[model samples]
Target chain A: MQSIIAVSELSKVYASGFQALKSIDLDIRPGEIFALLGPNGAGKTTLISIICGIVNASTGGVTVAGHDIRRDYRVTRAMIGLVPQELTTDAFESVWNTVSFSRGLFGKPANPRYIEKVLKTLSLWDKKDDRIMTLSGGMKRRVLIAKALSHEPRILFLDEPTAGVDVELRQAMWEVVRSLRDSGVTIILTTHYIEEAEDMADRIGVINNGELILVEDKNELMRKLGRKQLTLQLHDPLDTIPDKLSAYGLELAAGGVELIYTYDTQGEPTGITALLGELQQAGIRFKDLNTTQRSLQEIFVSLVKKPA
Target chain B: MNFYAIRAIYLFEMARTGRTLLQSVVSPVISTCLYFVVFGGAIGSRITAIDGVTYGAFIVPGLIMLSLLMQSITNASFGIYFPKFTGTIYELLSAPVSYVEIVLGYVGASATKSLILSFIILATAGLFVPLQIAHPLWMLLFLVLTAVTFSLFGFIIGLWADGFEKLQIIPLLIITPLAFLGGTFYSIEMLPPVWQTVTLFNPLVYLISGFRWSFYESSDVGVGVSLAMATLFLATCLVVVWWIFRTGYRLKT
Candidate 1:
């Protein structure tokens, strides 16, 4: 797939000597949902700001849709849409006017029909005539999304789009995002919610301490680091592991009423067959057994916890 | 040039002025009328006239300049500052519009507002005192040049100010006092020799002098020097604004 956005050796250092981002390089594939996951103050916003042209990068180069960000700002910016982290809208402006004005800012000719479609897609058509300040918080966020989509950008950046949103609204927003992506807009979102990334992202980038520590396909990252636990309810209690099954790494839990076995999914044969035979030979009968795979959240926590 | 983008921002700002009619339009007009009443009515009865023009007519240019300076700064500064305050500036900064286009939209709207106020004040002054324009074209030239110059200055202040209080500081403390002492109500020639020389150092004096000359053909300084000073101030403002956009000072992180 062709890269829609590219960043090479990007870095940002504020006047106060605080380095918000280190030398970083990234490429966003066309027609893909790329999720950038990070903890608080992890430079996710700084990275997004540079690409959106809201903040100047201290050093580096970025190109969007084959146009250099610095040299061809208008061209690059017109190809991108940004739903910023803040809910900033003109209080007195009607929703219709605000969205239409945003389209004009991109130097696009006025198209009321396109504007109407964008508003309707975000479910904000009913409130189009209402002043922005009168809308609910969720409705206001929808308006921001409508404005971002007004110019028919090829790439959209959602910076913590669901940070303060309620669960029902967040799900609704996710549906809207999915539909937008289905219509061919490449979406890049920065979020701390591992579940959100796991559910929606095709690929995930984990940023920590001004660095991107990992970037991989969502499924691959999970399968590579994911571990499984097999829990067995014992038919009878036991004091400890029997000598015959001492080779297997098994533990007694639930006060010896259960046996727990942990193993990597990628490990050799998972050791399940041999372990099961050993348990049977040792006369350790199981009443019930269940297996659970590690969630993406756990993998993320472990990745960020490793010392650089 | 992205004329569409410029028009979008310009219309948005002008729409804001309409929404705040009581504060933007009515307030300035009422305040200037009061200045005409107190100075042109009460003071005119005592002084009669200054430099052959009636007291009411003599101060007309100065009063217009005073309101122009204040309104231009206030309108432009607040026009940009409110977006910064509300955090909507990020949207604009990320838009495809260039810095020059953004400045043109904002400053253009602000200058238009000030010009409208000046004409309204001019009409109000006519109701109280007979008015004459020795150089009608020059009068308009001065009005437009001064409005555009101060509006640009206000754009700089808006970009530089980080707080609401900072927005009002320059117009209230520096520009207002300078206008008052810049011979708005009285000619600097009436001052002592030493004070007259000192008053010449105030830039507002040149603006008021050149503007008054356009109206009554009377000025504290030579008309050519006054026009030159106004142009110089305008050039300086343009340079500062250019630097702000280039360096992204207080605009980009």
Candidate 2:
């Protein structure tokens, strides 16, 4: 499938000699949620800013649709809506006017109906007449989303949209993002929250130290990296594991009251039946057992923790 | 051409003025009126007329030019500077609108605002002293040219400034001093030869001199030179603005 947005060897070196982004090449598929997971100062914001034309790249280029972002800025920018990390707004301006201002700034003709729909979708219709300063922080964030959607953009770049939002609002925002994706708008969000990416993204990209460390489909990443552990509660405590069970790579915990068996989740047979038969022949008894699987959070930690 | 974007920004800036009526309109008009009362009424009572015009009437054009220059700079500088201060400029940087449209919207609103204030001062000057404009069209021309030129200069200042103090430094330390030395109240002819020559170097003198010529048909320099100088300054400002956008100086990282 053709990509809706393409980035080729994009890099940015600021005036202060800080390299915010290394050579980054990416393709954003149409109507897919691509979550960029990175720690603070990992260049997520810089990458998005460069693509949105707020920042210029020091090397390489980017193309939105088929046109170069620099050569055809108007066409590319008209197709993108950016929700910046900061909650910046005109405190004195009313909600309606500011959002309307955004639609017009994109060279779109007046469409009060569209603006109304956006505000209503973001749950900001009731506060449309109120000054931005008078609204709550959550409402202010929603206003930012409304402003981004005001132009009916095909691609939405949300930079830490739920950074300081409460859980309830975060869920609501996720619903909004899902619906936007459903309506054929491509979403590329950057977040430090592992759960956010796990729950919302179709594909995830991990960035660390100005480099894109990994990019994979959400389920595929989980399936490939996930490990399972079978922990068995013993009938009695033992000081050491018997030598006969050495092939099983069993680890004794809880003062030898339990045995933990680590294995790949994709491994066939899991060796459980053989291990149980051997334990019974060795006169070992088990009280209870439970299985555990590694979560995306653990997988993420392991990927980012490796030496660059 | 992104005409709709230009109109949107222009209206947004104008609406800001409407919201801050006391500061944007009333305050500047009141302060300029004070100049008329003090210089035109109090001091003019003792000085004789320079040419056929009365001392009180002679300062009207100069005073209007003074206010026009100052207000043009203030309106435009603050208009663009506030967005940078508040971080709302991101929307502008990311929008589909071109730099030309941005300049048109901001400088256009700023020039229109300065023109409005200048006309109000002109109207108020009428009640205090008799007024005559020998070439009304020429007067209007000078008014618009000065407003637009200074407003463009202000846009440059706004882009160059990083802090609020920097925004004020040029308008207060440089532009205000230049306007005063540019023959706002007294004509350059009244100065010593060397001083008059030095005053002639101040570019604002041409703007004020041309504007004064339209009012009383008398000026320190020929109207042709004044108009040429005004156009030259305008062209120079345009070139500088174009370079700023081309280089993305202070606008993009």
Candidate 3:
């Protein structure tokens, strides 16, 4: 149950004076699917780049399983795998050679059986002998995954793993991730797809403007941040909210044909009962009534905006 | 760095420039034959020998060295630059390999290509004019040194370049012109005293002079000085490259 990856006060500043990461501190647990969500240029990729040893951090250090990434780089790097966002591969090389070569890069001994298994797991075995340039975009991506996993790393970093990929391939990738996780591989994924994280991540970390704003269990974050809205389809058109309805923060909607009431489910009382009673006293009646709950998508949008 | 990994990377790169085998092994032979036809066959009718050596034979070493130097720099520089421009460098950078492995693998392949081209050019030159190996050992040593030195130089150039065009600038504009002006087609001794002194300043002169001296017994430069100059040039290049790798100058950041 030790932290598989740790970052303390890490920051990255580019040569153009752009602050890519600012005072970030977080730790990822072993064998957990940790998804980092953020908008483009929000330092999610930068943070991953530093930990993957592809880019140098302007300040601070990161460690993988107690090995300092910069000082003990070989040991740290050997223990981790990174599938970069770019579709970069040896175009003229066969899928088999590319994955086998990648495994060799980690100083792993030749294991054709393992390479074949990785290719088959990614659905790339049939295309194993085909040149990389001839493969489709999704197939090439699968090859990158096979290459990343060929070395049998304990931790894997997939940066935007499903970008430009089809739904079927993405689902397949998710299954691969799940299997890897089941086998005790710690996964730190950065994705723009909120649903991908919402569906798969045990814990979610949201980063913005080079800062990590929040990290919490998926269910806990959703329950704590999610809000519900109560809607009333008024029987008669109301010109404005009544003075008595001021106690409840109800918003008139659809040109007075509907009223929407927002409240936290975690509150002592949602107050829908009291609001309905007050509406009756104020001569407010609805033809139909329903309530809708907020999702992680909404909470994410709100968190990205300035605190209000 | 794992040796097998380096070998794998080297073979992978060799495959990368697969098309270059045509250009490296074939193009140089064709180019040398053309040079022999126009410069050696036609020009030899009037000019006999520069200094007791046939004009065709005198320029043979220069022509071979010319292609070797140019091919070495272009092959190595373009080799690295294309991968960077094409975004394949990210795959390499993200791998669990070290920068040392990358350099050794790339430069090793480049050296192999340069040697291959150099020897082919030598054989092509033999078809036109005979070569006198006054000191076969020194000749072989000089060829190896020149190939390795320029290969390392080109590897650095490859890393420093940002674009495909940038990779060609040094060889097309600087190195080629320097080779011609350094008296690859002519002898410095024929020039006036001031021009001869000026030719000494060009680094290519030392390389070509050493190469030519190895073939001719009555050469002006000594073997020791030639080897020393070549060694110093190579050592300087290695140090700069090592420093760049250490700093990760334009690479990581």
Candidate 4:
């Protein structure tokens, strides 16, 4: 599929000389949830701001729906809806007015029906006439999402949409994002939560220190980097492992009452049967065994922990 | 053209004024009425007339111009500054609306506000003293041009200010002083020869002179020169605004 948003060689240098983004090239497939996973100060907001036309890029360019962001900003920006991380809103304005205001700002004609539907979708219909300052944190976040969707944008950039939200609201927001994706609105979210990307993204990109270190299919990334561990509860504690068992690279654990074996999840045959045979020849007995795979969180930690 | 966007911004700002009626409308109106009581009643009793117009009527144009300059700048500056302070400017910047539409929406609303207030003051002044508009059309022209010019200047101040204190610095320290010394209360002729020349350097003099001329057919400078000066200031403000948008100063990055 042709990409809906393309960022090529994009870099930003602030007046104070801080480089917020290195050369980042990304092509977001239409209708896919592309989660950008990064830690604090990793340039996620900067990248999103540049794409949404809030920030000027120091070098290179971006295109949305085949139009240059600078040359055809009206067309490009009209196609994008951004839910910024901060819960900034007009404290005095009613929810309905603010959302409608956003719609008009995108050059869209007045459509109270559409605004009503969006508010209802976000469970904000009851609070439509209420001032934004009267709402709770979670409701304000919903208001942001409603405003972003007001213009019926084809692409939505959600920058840390769930930050500071409770677990329940976070789950509900994830459902909303999923439904938006189902409706053919391309989603590009940036989050520090590994579980959020694991649960919601089709493709995940990891950025750190202004560099995009990795971008891959969510499942593919996990499978390729994932490792499995096998732990055996022994019938008897052993003083040491025999030389024959050394070939399996097994380590006595749990004060010698259990043994652990680590292997690549993608390794052929996993060497499990051969390791068991060697264990039996050594006369070691195990009461039970269990296996576990490394999670996306662990993979993420390892990936970001590397020296820049 | 994004006419809908412009309307959205304009209406949004106007609604804000409605919400803050005490500050936007009532306060300025009350203050101008008090000026009629203090300056027109007390001072006019002593100094009978200037340039053949009663002191009470003479100060009417100046007072209206004073309010127009101050209110136009305040309304427009605060209109744009509050968004920046509250961080809602992200939406404005990210929206598809162009810079021209943004300025038109904000400055247009501000100018409208000053215009309305000017009329209100004019009507109230009628209650205190006999009023005459020598050229109502010219008066309207000066009122609009001055409102828009000051509003544009205020927009620049809003963009340049990073703090609430900075927002007040120009209007309070510079503009208010300039307006007072710019022949708002006394004609430039009342000043000595050297002071009159020095007063000519003040831009507000031309605005007040032209505006006062529209009311009493009396002015310190040629009406044509005053109009040209006002247009020149408006052009300068427009150029500054265009440059701000082109460079993305204090807005984009």
Candidate 5:
């Protein structure tokens, strides 16, 4: 599939000598949900701002839908919709007018039908006549999404769309985002929620210290770095592992009532059978045992923790 | 050239004015009327006339210009500043609309609001004093040019101001004082020779003089020079606004 947005050698340096972004290159595939994961001030917003033309790139270029962003600003911007991190709406304006006006800002001709559809999809149709200031935080967020979608752009950039939202509302927001993807809009979201990226993104990009440190298919990234652990609940307490079992690198915890064995998921044999045989010969008994896999959260923490 | 975008921004701003009618329209009108009551009624009764026109009639142009300069700046500056304050400017910056279109929409709506207020004040002034507009077209010409020019000036202030206090500083401290000292209530001829020369340096003097010229055919400066000064200020504001957008000073990061 062709890339809908291409960013090459992009960098941003603020006037105060703060380097927000180092040289970075990225391609957002057509119709894919690409999640950019980063810690605070990790240049996630800076990158999005540059692509959306809210911030000028100190170096390099960006193209959206085959048009250079700087040279064809209007063309590229018209094809993209950005739901900013801030909930900045006209306080006194009704939801209907605000959303309708946003469409007009894109130079698109007015279409009430399209506006109604976007509002309804976001569950904001009921409050369309209400002033934005009167809406709840979740409802206000939906209004922002409705406004972003009002122009029916093919690319949507949601910056932390689920931040500070309740679980139920986040799920509802995810549903709306999925439906938008089904309609052929390419979505790029920046988020601190590992679970959100783990659940939604087809591809993940992890940024750290102003650099694009890792980018890979979600499942592939997990499978490549994932580890498994077999936690055995021992029948009785033991102060130390037998010398014969020390080679397996097992850890005794819960006052030696539980024993944990860590192993690489990709390695052959896992050594579980030999460890079990040695345990039985040593007259060790287990009450129960269970296996678990590392979550994306853990992989993320480990990846970001490594030195640059 | 994005007319739809411009219309969108312009109408949005105008709608905000409607929502805040008291602040945008009623407040300025009421304040001007008070000036008419005190300066026009009490002083008019005592002094009768200045330069053969009734004191009430003589100050009418200055009064209108006073509100025009302040309203034009207040309306435009607040219009843009509010968006920046709320961070809604990000949506505008990210939109396909060009910088020129954004300025047109904001400045256009602000000027429109000031124009409406000026006319209302004109009609209200007529209610208090028997009035005649010697050059109705020139009155409108000065009215529009001054509104557009000062609206641009207000736009610069909006971009330059980082806080609400800074937003009001120019209109309150700088423009209002200059308007009063620029002969909004009395003529420069009423002042000493040295003071009149110093007052000439105040740009508000030219705006009021030219506007007063349209009403009574009497002014401290030639109508041409007044017009020239207003135009020069307009051109300078345009250049500054252009440079702002070009450099992405405050509008873009």
Candidate 6:
């Protein structure tokens, strides 16, 4: 299938001499939730900003649904919806007006029914007549989402949609995202929340210092790059790691009451049995042990820690 | 830009500005009343009428337009500047709105406001000053054009303002003083030759002159010269605002 969103060799150099995006090429498929994960100042917002036409790109080109973002911005922008991180709405404006105005901004014909559907989908129907400033933070976020969806865009960009929102609201937002994807909307959300991406994203892309490090299927990214951990609860508290434990790279924790050993999950041998035998021989005994596969959060941290 | 969308944005902006309706109604009334008392009553008592018009009558045109100019610019500038201050411009920018739509919507709403308030002040002026309207249609025409010109100038100010401080600086420091010196409460012909010439540089003089010309059947300053200056001021404001929008100055990175 042709990529729904294609960015070729994209780069951004800010006026303040910061190179935000560094010649990064990326493609996003239709009907999938693609999460762009990165650290602070990692070009996540800059990349999204450029694609949304909020910021101009220094080099390279972006095409959405086959329409160029630069040369044919109106159609490309019409096809895309961007929910920015800020909760900036007309403070005195009713929720309905805010969302409707957003649709009108896209040159869409007035369709009250369509607007109502969007508000109901985001659970903003009840507050449609209420002023924006009076709504709670999460409700305001829902309004932002409603506004983005007002234009019925095929591609939606959520820039940290769940930031500063409560867990319940986050879960609510994820449900909305899932339904949107089910309805064939392509989603690209940039976030530091790995669990959100882990739970929702079909594919994950890691960006650091304006360069994309890797983009892979969720399961493949975990299985290929994830590292497992063997955490042993010590039967006896000790001052230091035993000499024999050095080879295993064991880290003493909580005054030696627990030990953590990290190993690559993709390695041919996990070597847990050999490590236990060595620990027994070294006079270290644990009543219980637990093994864990790498989480998306850990994978994200390690990926960003790597050199740009 | 589509008219429906522009109206939507315009109505949305007007609603936001409606919160200041009290301020909008009160500020001009208070200022006009004070000017009427101080300049019209106190100063007029000291000097006789000019061109057989009372001091109260002389200030009617200038006072009404002053309210129009101040309110139009303040409202437009604040409307745009507050969005940036509150970080709401990001939401606006991300929307599928064009620069022209943004300008027309904002400036249009402000122009509407100034027009409405201009009528209010003009009505209020009648209660205190026995001002004559030789041509009510002409008066309304001048009122409208004055409002439009100032509203456009205000739109440019909105784009030029970066912060709250920056927003108020031009209106407070520049526009206010120039309006004061632009023969708002008096005629430039009454001033010495050099002061009258100095007052000629203030573009507001032409705006006030155009407005005053409509009040009486005749005018001391030629109507053509005043209209030409008003047109020039309006054109300059349009070019500057269009340039700002096209360049995406401060709006885009």
Q: Pick the candidate with the highest DockQ.
A: 2
Write out the backbone clash pairs for model 1.
none
- Residues forming the 10-long window of minimal summed lDDT in candidate 4 chain A: A241-250
DockQ of 1: 0.87
Comparison by DockQ, 1 against 4, better one:
4
Interface RMSD of 1: 0.8
- Rank ordering of all candidates by lDDT, starting from the highest: 4, 2, 5, 1, 3, 6
Across residues A103-207, which tens digit of lDDT does each residue of candidate 4 receive? 999999999999999999899999999999999999999999999999999999999998899999899889899999999999999887888898899999999
Ranking by DockQ: 2, 4, 1, 5, 3, 6
**Per-residue lDDT for B1-253 in model 4, tens only?**
9999999999999999999999988998899888888888987879858989998899999999999999999999999999999999999999998999999999999999989999989999999999999999999999999999999999999998899998899999999999999998899999999999999999999999999999999999999999999999999999999999999999877
Candidate 3 vs candidate 4: which has greater TM-score?
Answer: 4
Encode model 2's per-residue lDDT on A1-308: one tens digit a residue.
88899989988899999999999998889999999988889899999999999999999899998889999999999999999999999999999999999999999999999999988888899999999999998999999999999899999999999989999999999999999999999999988788898999999998888889888999988888878889999998878889999999999998899999988867787798899999999989999999998888898889889988
lDDT of 3 by residue, A1-308 (tens): 66889998999999999999999999999999999988889999899988988799988888889999988888888888888888988787899988988888777888999998898899898999999999999998898889889899999999899999999999999999999999999999988788899999999999999999999999999888888888989999888898888878878889989999999989888798888888888788899989887877788889988662
Quote the chain B TM-score of every prediction: 0.98, 0.98, 0.94, 0.99, 0.98, 0.94
Please identify which of the two predictions, 1 or 3, would achieve the higher lDDT against the true structure.
1
| Cα-based RMSD of candidate 1 | 1.4
Q: Which stretches of model 3 miss by more than 4 angstroms?
A: A230-246, A251-261, A272-291
Off by over 4 Å in 2: A253-257
Off by over 4 Å in 4: A238-242, A252-255
Of candidate 2 chain A, the 10-residue stretch with the lowest lDDT total is A262-271
lDDT of each: 0.91, 0.92, 0.85, 0.93, 0.92, 0.85
Task: Please give the fraction of native interface contacts (Cα pairs under 8 Å between A and B) kept by each candidate.
Answer: 0.87, 0.95, 0.55, 0.90, 0.87, 0.63
All-Cα superposition RMSD per candidate: 1.4, 1.5, 2.7, 1.3, 1.8, 3.6
TM-score result, candidate 1:
0.97
Report residue A259 deviation for candidate 5 (angstroms). Answer: 3.5
* The candidate that achieves the highest lDDT relative to the unseen native structure: 4
